[model samples]
Target: MKDTTIDDISLISIPKIKEVRGNLGVIEGDVIPFEIKRVYYLYDVPSDAQRGGHAHKELYQFLIPLSGSFDIKLHDGINKKTIHLNKPDKGLLLVPGIWREMDNFSSGAVCLVLASQKFNEADYIRDFKTFKSFKR
Candidate 1:
């Protein structure tokens, strides 16, 4: 069974250390549930462009907006949610089997992603209908 409901999605708060010079954000092993196997980022997005029109079979991802802002639309078989990411110290945790689409990126927005697995095309459900069937 490769499925998790939308309720499984969660918000994660990264620990921040304040300083006079600059504030530092931390994403230690304890801050996230999984051992991150990959790190990537999306930037320089056009305002009308969108991303992530897919779902994973068994991958978990944590997405953070390092700069500017963006909106992520998530959907389960029966439920849907939209989340806005703006702060650098906050992130969204996406469990497996949930559909996700990203859009409305502010100029210079940088979306950092921490994944539990390395890039694998076989793990992705790129079609919404297939994703819905998978969730069942």
Candidate 2:
């Protein structure tokens, strides 16, 4: 597994075009670090609820908050960081091998995740212990 750190994470700004009707944000394949293969979103989370308590072995992800706000706690076995997501035109880029936990979700917060790979159960490391071992 790769040794990831907070430095590897970046806040990407999506292109926004302002119009009289409304504003639009565009995300193209070349805009991000990796090509997106899967797309998913989390919504309807309770204020006290949390999500994403796992690490990926090879998959990369980009997280964006479509509405409200939330915090994503990332641990790379050696370092940890907390990132807040609230803007629709910004996203958090998460590299592989970093364990992550999403929490502090406000009511009606919608988190959109763009993945570099398709869903594979084996790619997930759900246990902190196992994820730490992979870091070593």
Candidate 3:
């Protein structure tokens, strides 16, 4: 796998259609850099709770705020950056080998995630030290 940097992360704009009832945002497989194999959403999280303190070996993820706002802290083993996901029409594209942590969730925040791979515990590097060594 290629070493991913902070620059590799991007904000993708999904097509949104405005209507009288409500707005609709569409996301297709080709809209992102990778194919979608799994989909999940996080909701009803406590204000003090955090999520995702690990790095993936090959998985790719696209994250969006389906409801409220939250912040994602990303580290490429050398550089760190924080990205906020607050809009329903925008999504964050995350590549492999990057450590990430999500926090600062607003009330009723719903985080929708599109993943390129299925659930596999072996693909995850939960240790920060192991992730740094893997980047080297």
Candidate 4:
């Protein structure tokens, strides 16, 4: 029984070229079609700790689970959806005005995130209550 608020989240599967012993995953312009300006990863997290408890005001993000699995709870001010990221060849496309939280991450999970813009504190809506108000 988990409680989530956002709903527009979906699993995005990227194209993968397979080989004999190795596989290559690519996110081309035709694949994602968004200008990825920022790239980052989340790692070295404690077992009971949770990450990503904020909402972006204008930043669109693509989230990929490079290793292990995790649950992405997304809220679009009205509806809610929980997206699970476990495969490296897929990612989650999160649009702006969506409140998101990442939790239930397995041990040694690596989350790769791609953003449409650089770091900006004004672009993030940290307070959940304020996010709700802005949702309208």
Best by TM-score: 1
Task: Give the deviation of candidate 3 from the true structure as CA RMSD.
Answer: 1.0
Q: Provide TM-scores for the models.
A: 0.97, 0.96, 0.96, 0.90
Each model's lDDT comes to 0.93, 0.91, 0.93, 0.81
- Residue pairs clashing in model 3 are none
Give per-residue lDDT, candidate 2, residue 77. Answer: 87
Separate clash counts for every candidate: 0, 0, 0, 6
Off by over 4 Å in 1: none
60-122 per-residue lDDT for model 2 (tens digits): 999999999999999998899999999999999999899999999998899999999999999
**Model 1 residue 60 distance off true place after TM-score fit, in angstroms:** 0.5
Candidate 3 stretches greater than 4 Å from native: none
Write one digit per residue (lDDT tens) for candidate 1, span 42-76: 99999999999999999999999999999999998
Report the C-alpha lDDT of model 4 over 1-136, residue by residue, as the tens digit. Answer: 0122344455678889999988889898666647999999998666577788888877878999999988887777777777778999999888788888888889999999999999999898889899888876
- Per-residue lDDT tens digits for candidate 3, residues 75-108, read 9999999998999999999999999999999999
After best superposition, candidate 2 residue 67: deviation in angstroms? Answer: 0.7
